[model samples]
Target: MKHTIKATWMRGGTSKCWVFERSELDVPGFTTDEVLLRLFGSPDPRQIDGVGGGSSTTSKAVILGPSDEPGIDVEYTFAQVGIDQAVVDWGSNCGNCSAVIAPYALKRGWVEPEDGILTVRIRNTNTGQILIERMNLDGSEAEAFIPGVPFPGQAVDIGFLDPAGATTGALFPDGKELSTLSVEDEDPRTRSDITATLIDAGAPVVIIDAQTAGLGTADFRQWPTACTAEMPRLERIRRAGAVAMGLAKTEEDAQRAIPKLAIVAPAESGSDADIKVMMLSMGAPHPALAITGSVALTLGAHHPGTLIAQQLASAPDGELRLQTPAGLITTWQRQIDGQLAVGTSRTARELADATLSFDPAGERTENPAVILAQGTGLDEQQLEPDPPPHGRRTVFASVAAFAVLGLGATLVGGGLLNPPATTADGDYAGETLEVVIPLAEGGGTDTWARFVGQELVHDIPGEPGFAPINDAGGEGITGSNRFASSAADDGTELLVSTATTVVPWVLDRHVVKYSFEDLEPVLVNGTGGVIYARTAAGVKSTRDLIDRKKPLVFGGISATGLDLTTLVAFDLLEADITATFGFEGRGPVNLALQRGEVDIDYSTTSSYHSAVEPIAKEGSATVLMSFGQLDEHGEVVRDPNFPDAPTVVEVYKDLHGKEPSGPKLEAYKTLLGLTYTYQKGLWAPKDAPEEAVDLLRDSAHELSGDEEFNKKAAEVLGGYPIVADENLSQRVKDAYTVTDETKGYVTALLKDSYGIELD
Candidate 1:
């Protein structure tokens, strides 16, 4: 007899799965398994007669129902149906599929919607875990785009509370932060033991260092190929880990569905993510990360001595961003009472709803046809009139039909029934915007790029989302040149320029292949700086600084970079100061000042607040002068943001008993204007269309007026005004201009004092 079941296919995060309302499936325990296996066409390598998508990621199912438990809306059981095996492993919950539960419930009327945010509590029957979903009911599509997913939809915030022991009842199943697993090898010369972290949060996970597995590269793109080649060794290690975690009584009983393995390495320099990870699902590399695995990995990152924890030792608090093959995934964890609460945002959309029908008698049929509504079934030629007993051709035909029908249904349901139309303005309507930050992650430039990119998501016309790509190398020259030479002029590509980039171009450095003149500025961000001295130097004020006998040591970078202004300021003041160059950035220089390695140092206003304010409060450092902001008349004036600190000009006049003037003063003002007043800005290729430039400028102007943005700017940019619209053009022109007299004076000063020649 033929039996039919209603099912909904949905895309959750990067994976797609078949979802079923549990109460509707009347089949009993073992019978239900048999029915689902037949429906999925499992046990055959190709699952030719079933609805499986062939790959492990697509061949998954969820059975959800209204939960009777208090405060819980739904209870869902996640099943991983093997493609080549007639086995349904309920060993773990699928994080990606779990994301669909709340949405499915809302659609099914299992949960009532509220006026604002709807909260849904879910019980994962497989792992006996609770997942809370907070959804915005504004009916607006999610604007945040994740990597790998082609479309954007509604965003759902999922929280896995106390997930540390969801599956195994213990944070570390082995009762140790780090466990050593013994591996039998063909070669005795190599290491026989591997160190791993065996923890059970959303799922049982095995964490190990990529270097230990001989995967030395931190590049995520190379991981899949490397994993495919070393599967046997990796599987052996996984089995050993399973034994260590006590999840398997013997290696033979170890299931590939449980205890997922993840190889991790420290993120490359300038990367926006704290760590780089590659996850393995069902014996193959996952193209994107698993939400369940992310939860487990997040907990491991917080646990001390674990491999993941050690790599994230310096990670910022509150949000932990990880780099995956698909892009950046941010996760947050907080301890409530004694249990750890983990949260992440995921996007899900329902694709189609249909009743699936198949004859149980034809379970072994090689070429079985699936019946769907709306004539969305396989072609007659693809379905055999007489079922074949067994053959590769039948398998091929069945799999092809499944894919074609599935895709057709999705396209028809998703409003992609027709070809996409272009916008009249030729703006970036459907294109993915890439914002390039030519600095290592966690630097000032990266921070600014991410902030601006986030704000641009809402302000830009067509509401195109922005992806910040950190191409840190060659001291900012590599990314700058790549953007100039390769980026298209369709307003989809933008470069975030900082003083690191400006200085290279201004000095005519050999490493710089791109010209500032070849770029068009859209928004210029102004930052202020303060030069201070360590209290140990005994120079409490500008007067004390002049009278001090000791020559103050200034820790700085290359003089041709941001430090050029500080160096020129030192010469103008006639203070006995010697600069020790080659510090990586302002961060290191600030550290040096605290350690007394440098008696005097300057930090941008933002850094001054976070890193230096404490030193000053502790009486370890004293502020001497602020670089200040330019007035309407283009004269250095006291910064309204830091009213207490006097301008460099004020400090100079007080120290020298005369107004500061000369070619040196002109050069100092020129470089200072370039470095502080227009330190960072947004730019596009010089040849970009005029419409694109205007759109970006208008978007930035709108963003600058946003109350939330202005509040954040006060905290990060020291309340400095964002130069946009009419002011932006003049700002760019001023920053790019250096008079011959001023240039000559700066060039001569560098050659004479620092024994360095300018190009």
Candidate 2:
């Protein structure tokens, strides 16, 4: 008679394992080990009777159960079953297997799923540590992908918090950074002392220098063949170090598994990894990295005076990239609220879900021939079988379950399903919107994009949410062109534009492939600018600027960008100013002024408040003039935002004794109108459907009026007003329209003054 048990075969990171729910198994406490041993066909060199893959990586198991611990959702125990012995070691946890527990729990309804990134807390019974898994979930689909995994699947980020003492209750289990172990030589009378670092981070690991280990190359692939002759010597060192670390009573008692051995050396030039590491699992070379080993290496890299720290070139910036036999794996480590948090990416895939039948009365089928045929490579046929009845549920069932749980179906069968009309008040009820920002993260444009995206989630109809993707490069040309060429016109994709994008387009830059005219404006963001001067240049007020002797060196970005207005202001005031162009952005230009690299610079209100305000208050810098805002009659007027500062027009009149009017002033007005009055805008393809455009316009209008949005916007946007509806379209037209005379004058000025020619 056969006893059937439910099981899930999965590939976690680079390793494969079988996952089982604890309650489903009928075996008792100590006897459970015997059943698993027989089920995996262990205790024989080539156990063909069961499902062991004949290698340590392929021979692993995880038992999952609902956790009774506070704040932990599930408890998972990782077992390392021996390939050639009836032994099950539950001494340590598998980081790769730990990544899958959360997803499995979510699928089994062990934890409730939330929109956006979902956090699942799990307790690893083996190491007695808690792990947090953060995953991006869009219904049943996940977003991230691990770089080194061979297969295609969603990658989950698992963070081990305060992992320094996960295993042995101390970072250095043996309470020493360096330890010397004496190993017997082949001559039987000779002995050599090897230096190793025995530390417990994600796992207990013994780290040794590759050169001292007599390993010819640091390349892990070569180590398997090159270190074959010295395997016994290395194992002896591991055993000795294990006893010293108190993991074993004697060298013979050490299973040669738990404190895995690692050979390290300096990374080769042109490699992405900071260092090269080769890990051995169960006396064999690991083709790729173990996630826990990566955590251990990360901790060691940060720790002072360890072998890994000595070999490393410098301290890593949050993430540590290590080279392995397979490829590079990056791990990030940081202290959050005094806890050491280590995070790494791992991809999990459900290979097969079925019932495995076993017999206690039947003959043991331990065929070495079958085990040899299986080899060491991943056997997809054996690991993945046809989905069982319980596993092959229909999409309708999932949708019904979501509805009952009060979570609408944002995605069904990987396709977006339109929500009901009442939910969205339109057709785009259950859609996921993406807002593309053409700047790097932490910049003003990215901040604006995030703010708008968050507000849109609240204002847009239905259960729609917006996510921002920063595709920053080519000084904003890359992301703008990407959106123009590839973004879908179904109202799902929107572009976050800044002066960096509009300036290139207006200047006819060769790299600017996108046309502002080809896009439709849905919203316009208006921000004011202030021209400031370094106090060391002897300019405190607008009057002092005209009396200055030395030519004020103005730091600017590009001649055709927003700096055009500042350049024209210099001409209008008849000020002795020399323009130095090619700064990345206003932030860099301000830094140049602060460092005394330049005498004068202009910054948008947002940057001026955050960065320049402190310098101004310290008497290092002085505000000279504000660009101000244009009135309805197209006259430069005092900006309501900066009521204390005089307008640039007022400053020019005060200095030159006349109202500013010329080709320079016209060009300045055109550039100012384009850059300052409507510095940032939300746009979509010109041919976007009228209904979608109206929906977006309405959403923006609602967002602008929202009190919560206004409060947040004041902090992020420097109190800029969000211009929407017809006013937004009119602003775009006014900014883009320029007279032939003004354009010719600006083009010539760019060439003669700044040595820049418009294409």
Candidate 3:
């Protein structure tokens, strides 16, 4: 049986979490931990089987419920779902994810906004910390800004109430605020002792001087790879500090999530920040300070005799300025209800709203070290907020996924293994749809395949299990040939085709052994892009191609890859251009063009928004023409998305006074048909069961028409259309039929113009 939960994926501060109302996840016969672990595709580094983004910050879950406690609006549980392990660590609180609470509550109508402002009390069930968030309901995206994030969002004010004793019921958990931690190396003879301040407020932390770890103030200025190589010492410090705070009985029993550690140093004179700080989470240098850890660091810096306070030459008038790796963070401290409180500002945004169904019985790789973090998962919470009888944290031995919710991530999510069903009507209850993507994981093609294939299977008969295998090499040809020659011929297997592989085959490259003509098309997608030129190159329009004093320089990944379409377009237009092959990808080519190394480039519709428009608007480049979509009669027409831009055919007509005809134009159209119109697709082996093939295609068709899937796949599709029409099969077959004349033309053009020999 499959269990589904409605979720809202939101980014709070630096961490992103899948938010769920408590009632939606409190179902019977299953624990929230089990549901999240499966939904997140844990025990897999990539988390390809689930929605997890295969990282710490992206693999978190926030469970919110109405709070019956007086003056508190909601109580929430933050689950640190594992990305590459089986454990969910809830030993402490996440201030980063907390930034998401008030906005989510307002969006869900859980809280009411008063006169364009929203104030709500959110209690972190993990640490009994009641946080108050004051959000400007009218805060426009342009009004908010923070460190690490390249863009702005709604700014929120989060204050921790009486945060001092939230963890161990004392500001300084070890009685003394200042202490020395002697971290020993493998050779006990060699020891590294560091001065530290152990505190319990804002999620319990160990604050230390940077110099104690052999780092000085100079390290704070433009520090590259900041402390990544200090893992050994940091781990020792984290474990040692855990014991000093009485959170653990010994270093070996220290928990992975709690008693955070931070290194502090004074910022350079005249710098905006008062002090600079670096944090280590799960023994790795944090890209930025943890929202909760920063609260503690702020409090410690304000306290009279703490290490952080000593580093600050002087206290700030109101806010504490912290210089972190990403940028500067501003924090404030105040008295709330006569109790000490610290707060910071963060901007949050909702990424997606969807229902995710997970299978509890799918697979569970047992790791004895995984300690349950919730109350119901194992009849008890192993790592609770409750301090032990010794007035310290309870020691627990375990390694868990430390997914950090960091910015600069475009969050864009494995399959079960089972036997193949022989017939189309056969239920795939125990079967797995193994998709072979001939590209490296985390690229554009891989992201698309995982998104479509992973979700489309849910609509298939019995909702077969999904497993995507990336056999990346040879720029996709290696994996393509492997799949073509060896993948199961049953319906259980499918091949993913993109321009990288399609172009090679069109040129009849000797490396391409897999014939799309032999495979059956299940589904296909069409994309549109446009050729652009750097205005800096002294070219204003297509007319400049014939009488240019200097030929325009173009950068590309490879002539045999997607670049073939553009190369043919250049040929069709008879453009005076010098082609430079072997950049890396379109992005690099775009960068090179920007840097004036190349004078022209192209961008697909999806990236056109981020990559092209900005430069064009800045008057650095010109959008000369779009590749355009192929119509019923194989005629190019303006893309609905880019209608303002003329088609290449129109450009040719406008430049030369008539529609040019010849081998070059024919070859251009042929390459366009293969590389753009039918750019990406899925195919099943011809020998696969007839019933299975029909059923799979039917599901793909249904999924293609699904309103929800289309909405969710918009970004991944790069504004392309999932071609599942009744005539799609005919269209794909026609496009795949590379005529000998067109093939010979493209082949010769490659060898003559670019000096390439067909393998």
Candidate 4:
């Protein structure tokens, strides 16, 4: 008789696999290997009858159980079940599917939501390290939407709780600045003792200059051809480096996985990604690696002992641009020299994000993705992780859990994980913008806005003038409105805000009465989105969701507006949608999106674009439609970032009899018209002095034009250029031309959907 084991099929990164709870596989005496092989359907090219996707990368399994560790919410064990081979590798970690731990914990009842966001502390079973996966909830509900998955998925915000040298023994694994390892390849021309940076953040990796391999980091597709020609050399270097990094116990072990190889080049090199690092799958390069890896490489490049540090092209103390397979990745780093020891490389990765203001007079900006799944429950605790040999015993979980357990688990134990808290706060302090945001520190918008402030301080016309004050609360409007109302018009105080700034106005949910009209636009920054799903189900594409024949629930930043618009489109398409509103921010909403309880969500394109583009390409999620101004200017300029999908207008015309129109139609048009018209601008009160406003705007504009700023912006925006200007009033007005009917309809629509009756 066939052994029928319960398994959950999940899609992580570009791969798919079956998951089994530890309890489900407790058939005593059968080694873990025996059960895993049975799960993968060994020696079968066609795992046709099984959940395995057949590809080596896809035939994987994960077993999650309850963790009794004082600070951890759950314990996760990942098993890479081999296809056609009888081995199951459990030595390294899968950072991609590693994201699923929190969602899974919620589904199994490992964590309980407190208020807005529930922090699920995950003790990585592989590394015995703690990782905090921020889970957001709508009354004990998980919401989050990540890219590269189908439909809207559960959002589980993953942050390394104490991430230091997760792979290698030290942050800068090698004691020397650059290590020279002999090339084992047949190619005599390749350099012997090649310069490489072996740093351990989340993984052990060897970063080399593409030029060292006699190749350029131009296009990723071209690398396959280059690899084919130099396969022997590439293979040798990868293997040798793995041993040097201690990721491999034997020569053959490195050939399989761990200590992945990455090639970095100058951003001006016109490469596919300014820093093109191969993903987890060794045979086929990943479209892009995980964000954790990026952080790891960045840390390695700055240290003296790594190869990346030796080849360091001197960069100013500002934005550091990393070219990768996907595009340019921008990280705003502030270095603390004394902290650059072998195991302690302290730095901050500065990032930016934006919010939008809408009116019926203009086109609607693109609608970002939001969380759909709302996973429930937590598993019963069972697994325990052994601490790594050298590092401090760190547990990465929630503060509340630690407090309740009466244990002392440092956020970054012994300052080994991230930079010290004191240093982290002042990384960009003392010389900057005048505007201050009154929000919690380390928030997405807060981080980006502060980075922009740093840029202005570093390069703008009025250098050392602009300052950002943190006074964030009440959906980021109170602090922002404070800037709009009181800050000097000379552009000292600029409020960085989002669609919440406007959506609430239409809904009258915000106590502060204001609209896009109250603030003068300075320059639009950037935007990103959330992808969502439920934790219980592993549906990779929109097609999978549609096939399931269930109403895929979605959540919104607010009740109506952009999030609702996407659901309405689904409604028109006869796709099931159940949307909830009034969750703290996109951050929490994203956590819910991943739980499978809520199946869809909308987030900024910038945030989720990198993670999601591959999903669209892989046929997992439906592009549905983007909400942005119809590409005009006499020629249709495709979004180079998402080539397969059409513009919002194109999709609308294709889906319905006509394009999106009416008063709300005008609102949609107007919103899209200003899609990139600086959705979230650094603004002051309309009444602020023209000189102050001009000063701030001009400074911001000048900073935006800085070479470093431009390079980083290009990187973050996925190569699509951002237009940052000082005189946004004209730009805003030019994009704004609405009839009274359009205005009334927009207001009415907001009220009907959000329960707010705005005049």
Across residues 1-759, which tens digit of lDDT does each residue of candidate 2 receive? 567778988888767888889866564322455556667776443346777775566788999988888988888989886553344666667887777787788788888767666678888886678888877777454744554453466668888888886667888887888777877676769988888888888878889988877764433434533454455577788888788878899888886467788888888777778988888766555656777777888888887778988888888889988887656788998664576789787878888897876555432334322232223232222222112111222222223223323444476798647534332246455555667876655567776777677677667666463446666554676667767877877777788888778876776665576888888888888789888999988888878776566788998766665677788778778788888765656776777788789999887887777877899999999988899887667778877768999998888888888888878777777777788888888887888777887888888888888888899788777787787865777767877887889767777877777666554
Error of 4 at 759 (Å): 64
lDDT tens digits by residue: candidate 1, 500-562: 788768876554667878888988888998888898888788876664577888897667778
> In model 4, which regions exceed 4 Å deviation?
1-7, 138-150, 166-168, 182-193, 217-221, 239-258, 269-274, 278-284, 290-295, 301-323, 326-759
The deviation in Å at residue 174 for candidate 4 is 3.0
Error of 4 at 357 (Å): 53
* Candidate 1 lDDT score at position 387: 21
Model 2, which residues run further than 4 Å from truth? 1-427
For candidate 2, the per-residue lDDT at 55 reads 59
Residue 643 lDDT in candidate 3: 85
Between prediction 2 and prediction 3, the one with superior TM-score is: 3
| Each prediction's whole-model lDDT (CA) | 0.74, 0.72, 0.75, 0.51
| Rank ordering of all candidates by TM-score, starting from the highest | 3, 2, 1, 4
Error of 4 at 129 (Å): 3.2
Worst ten-residue run, lDDT, model 4?
367-376
State the lDDT of candidate 3 residue by residue for 224-319, as single tens digits: 222433445667888899988888899989987778888888778999889988876654456567778888888787777888888888976669
Whichever of 1 and 2 has more lDDT, that candidate is 1
On TM-score, the leading prediction is 3
